[model samples]
Target: MIPPSSCGVLVVGSGNAGFSAAISAAQSGAGSVLLIDKCPESWTGGNSYFTAGAYRIAHDGLASILPLVSNVSSEQAERIDLEPYTEADFARDMRTVCGGRSDPELSRVLVEDSGDAVRWLARNGVRFWLSFNRQAYEVDGRTKFWGGLCLRTPDGGKSLIADLQASAAQHGVTTSFSTALVDLRYQGSDGVVATVRCDDGRRHEITARAVILAAGGFEASPSLRSQYLGPGWDMAYVRGTPYNTGDVLELAVRSLGAQTFGNWSSCHSVAWDASASTDPNAGDREASNEYTKSGYPLGLMLNAEGQRFVDEGVDLRNYTYAKFGRAILSQPGHLAFQVWDSQTSGMLRAEEYRPERAEHITGRTIEELAKACADKGLLDAEAFVRTVHEYNEAVYAHRRENPSARFDPSMKDGLSTQSSGKRLSLAKSNWALPLDQGPFLAVKVTCGVTFTFGGLRVDPQTAQLLSPGGGKIPRVYCCGEMLGGLFYGNYPGGSGLTSGTVFGRRAGRAAAAAAAAVEEEGDLVRS
Candidate 1:
């Protein structure tokens, strides 16, 4: 169906950010809100449909969020240990992970508004749940939630999009699928004119008092990846919707002179299943986020050269997973193996590492595991065996030096492979254990790019697009991955979704107010 030629607010993209903007615009009294997406109806939520749905927010404690989630019972809540995540904690994480390059104002807004944004999501029909499967570990018979992430939507991103879409519809927002934004031109007080291509291969012009661009980044574009993120990025697997080809971003920059910001050479990449398809459009929507291979934090990773290249336990998986994909891509053949012993095999998230979901190579001993890896593509089986032996010795020496330092996955329990007596060239900083327990398991992984970090700069308060010349564009806004400067070299897991909602809501309300002002001016002119 062809969309109407005009609207109070026109939102491009049908993902979480777009839905948030459309819903908020209608709820904020925008007379007519329209949302459009380049993807078909089946790809309704875009990249958000493939997320684990984790949302990082600052809160008082478990009790603070208990009222919003449905997954925990009174009995379960008693056994759960959750510490308060303060605004300072969130800010520190952003600063640390982004290497102090994240935009100050953007990071501050995201940190301060995170909790309220999550609560707003719950109030708008999105069901919440404690992320026990991904964020918690059993310690001393108690469930300890770690990594400062505790909440998610049930069924992950699938339910998140469903609920948000329902809310948008309930608010009388109209949606058009298979509609691509071709160009956008801001007209100051006259409003904005957008050219869009519909599914029938027809082009139409849409005039709106305000426009919100949430059309995602350029991760799926091979040429853009190679150009912006440097070489070898084009080979990385596309983890989400292939439709985010950066068309809207490019148009905004070319036609509207939107200023781009943040780290263009970095992205939210992760260790993905090596067997996953490389074709941009061939993502297994049914399998969704299960293609992730994030169990490295519980084990160790070895490249084909059979060497431990990175500290797997440098921090919680949330902090390291996003950047490890780059490390893996730099390894030989862009491939690596994650090996775990029986001691920590059960701790792996079943959704990602279950035998049926992941192809695991197992052997009764470390040497046998190395041989199995050799068959898969390990260039040096002997080096693989020697590396394990050396790591085991270091772990043993450290254990002897500090016998009281117990292994704890719930916190940064410094059971590292470093001591006065022995130290590996690269140390596992936490949860280090000897790979002596058999049968050992290994899974091959390659880099998977989730989204790019480079995008248009927008005002932190209003989410309005900022001009290259230094002022906000009159009636234009941006949200989601399209609004850059929040992330840099790496990302803290679950923060992307939260940032999207925070900025999306802001852009929506601001656009609605702008539309109202335009309508008021027209009324006065007519009178």
Candidate 2:
């Protein structure tokens, strides 16, 4: 709890970014740091707890990356063929994924500081392990880890949140859960103070020298989703916290004159199980990120009309999954089914097989699978079978032309169907395999929005929220999903957590410095 009088620094939200700011501020010599969040302490980590805990960082090779993991067996280590992910590769991927519209300044900090930032997290007691199940494929007795995403915090987001909370407590930063920010009271001579809505439904005035708003975006508000993200967005299921109704973003913009940047229509959404719950307080950790159907690249997506609507293999799933949600939402009925044969069923993440959470069906043949999907009102039985047959013929034709080519899931191995008149409007550019294997599976999916891309703009150097006139908000800094401009049309996998840590560190240090400056100048005395 914050002292009734005042504090040196105040950090709002207890997610990775908020905790990062609080810990950093305390380390920077802030006398009193208070961390506040609207969620109860038991469920207070924000959407950070819903993450898979993947952190994308630039590393030379396995030798440089292996140390970050808390544990690794010699057998598992020796079988891994990990490649280098350089800073250039990270930058290129970020730009290419977002079509070059990513904020240059913010993206630079994310890419350049990602390595050290993750290391810093580990040093502060967050444990990580190679995301073996998500990032690796066992090929020829060797486990090959592809994509820039390799490390994940132990037990995924749950562990990451727990550890960060423990670390914050150890650093002498007081935390108050179920405390919502009512408003910011700015006194010209004394700087900014905040009015908070405490757990007991009473409002309290809290004074602080500096405040950092790491609160998240407006993904939870249906009306805001429709107004800002455009038509059909209100129906989208929220993948994380429901408390992130954009109150902080609105406060910073309308009340504090913060500049809003990034594409309002763009967001970090994913292909989520259609039956997933919409409640943020839904205590089902399995229903969190596990509901995501991210293995589309290894399979095909069929719309309600039994037609392919996207080039599922246009790129690695990491680069393409975020945008696929919008595509699914655009499909008829805002639904789609990801279909895969037995050849690749084992290839999907373990989450897909979770009986309690996944909406999956199995059939002995394509014909049977199509019928089963039809029974569930997911597709037209005949049309789906016809589509499968045509796709198979194309796959066979392509294989005959290049007999030596093979299907490799770890990378795009030119496993494509032949260009023919029967080709659907959208085609799978890579990893296109015939659904001839028995016991084929299909999982119904819809869009699950993770976070909004639009938020209060901030200076990359100091992490201070920027005004519309291009000036800092002085003592107020911003981080996490609240700090927009890094992402726009699309997102690179694992970059969210990396960004939270990077900007969180900068914002924490800056807020602490601002507090020290006020005290040193004797302009406004600290209580």
Candidate 3:
């Protein structure tokens, strides 16, 4: 096989972040840009293809959202009521969800520039729509959107990947799939050399004036998951591509002395169907994130011991879903069951109701539910009944105190239960309801990881990877899940995609500038 020598800018991993970097580099005057991915052409978008395509942007109201939303008729815009999600709210959400571990500078940049980053994607041909299916619900006669999550890439992650790749192609960005990076060698003031293996089993060295590593985190590799995330993480199902084996992270940190940040044990995980496929490349994939049971916030989560492990109503699903996976993993048998009644069952996302896809159990009464759970060998029947009885007493007491109060699923509507003398270790913060309603529903789930948080620390300003000595690594930059210090402990939903665009754009511009400088100073282009 003939080996191509070099390019102006090389982007590793052709997902949202990689494509964003390549397109921006090409548009910013870089003559040649190439993006390579380990996956073949069919599975090339990385984890972004599995995402919900949601983007968290800081906007003032429906009026300000009009410019960003696509195909919104004036009549529909006037009819919908969208609460303002300001910059302050964005920063507060990041800090709160990460347990105040997020870097202040990175948080500020993400919150302040999120709107512009989203608009930039829209300008680059990625389409957008109000997240009607996943985010909002209809109330009375009108549509009311809540949770500060309004924008989404239409048709979900698959469509987002298609459009971004199309934009990359339109702007003359070259893509090489099935090319895996094996090693990276940095030359002191010269540049970085990437050793890659192509589909033909041929190895080649590709040198570039600047490198933007957006390959992703270590969630897919079982060994890395066990090494960084601790003991039982290797058993958890991955919600994304298996190709993110921490190659770039290892090369940058161990080989180039890059500093790493964020909580290594923490990652963005969720309660996924225990029946889901562990194979990322499986064509008949049973649980490819369509199995995410996010409706636990509207119900109760009981572990195998027939005990509640987490306050399911502590916050919106967007704010708490990422961290609850740890709770599920810590449970006995590494499983949890989300129990809901007919009252809120209809409110669940359509994904939860797929007959062939979910591990669902239904019963007409609480006792029957316990029997069904016991029949499945998932929980103790007596212990489950006792737990339900105690919880229902609390709900009844709370309702008796406020007879006129009604349950609202749109937001944290202060629907909570009182202990009523049966004190439990964990308390439901809000949306607490009784299981007295018949025909109860329960879905079994285990922890499913999305992406690891701990990664190479970088300067958020230029997206340049920083060294252990607190200096830039010459011409190397990083983006996406590989850029650390922005999230820890937990992650607010939709921030991942938004941060990818923000840092990806910045890294691309910086990389293009660096490549141009090299050409000017040496008066020679290494092709």
| Best of the two (1, 2) by TM-score | 1
Tens-digit lDDT string for candidate 2 (1-527): 43354788999998999999999999999889999898777778888999998999999989998889956787788889999999999999999998999889889988999999999998899999998889988899988888788999888788999999898888999988888897997865455788888788888877888999999999989889999999999988888877888999998887789999887878988898887775632325655678888988888888988888888888888988989999999998899988999888878888755667687788998888888888776657788887778778888877777788887878888878755434545667789888888889999898999989998889999899899899888799999999888888899999999999999999999999998887776644543
The RMSD (Cα, Å) of candidate 1 is 1.1
**Off by more than 4 A, model 1:** 186-189, 278-282
Clashes of each: 0, 0, 0
The total of clashing pairs for model 3 equals 0
Residue 254's lDDT in candidate 1 = 91
Best by lDDT: 1
TM-score of 2: 0.96
Distance from true position, residue 237, model 2, in Å? 0.8
Best candidate (score: TM-score): 1
* Native-to-model Cα distance after best TM-score fit, residue 437 in candidate 3, in Å: 1.4
- In the range 266-371, model 3's lDDT, one tens digit per residue, is 8998898877764632212233458788988778999888999888888888898888888899898888888989888878888655677777799999888877
**lDDT for every model?**
0.92, 0.86, 0.84
Q: What's the residue-level lDDT of 393 in candidate 2?
A: 82
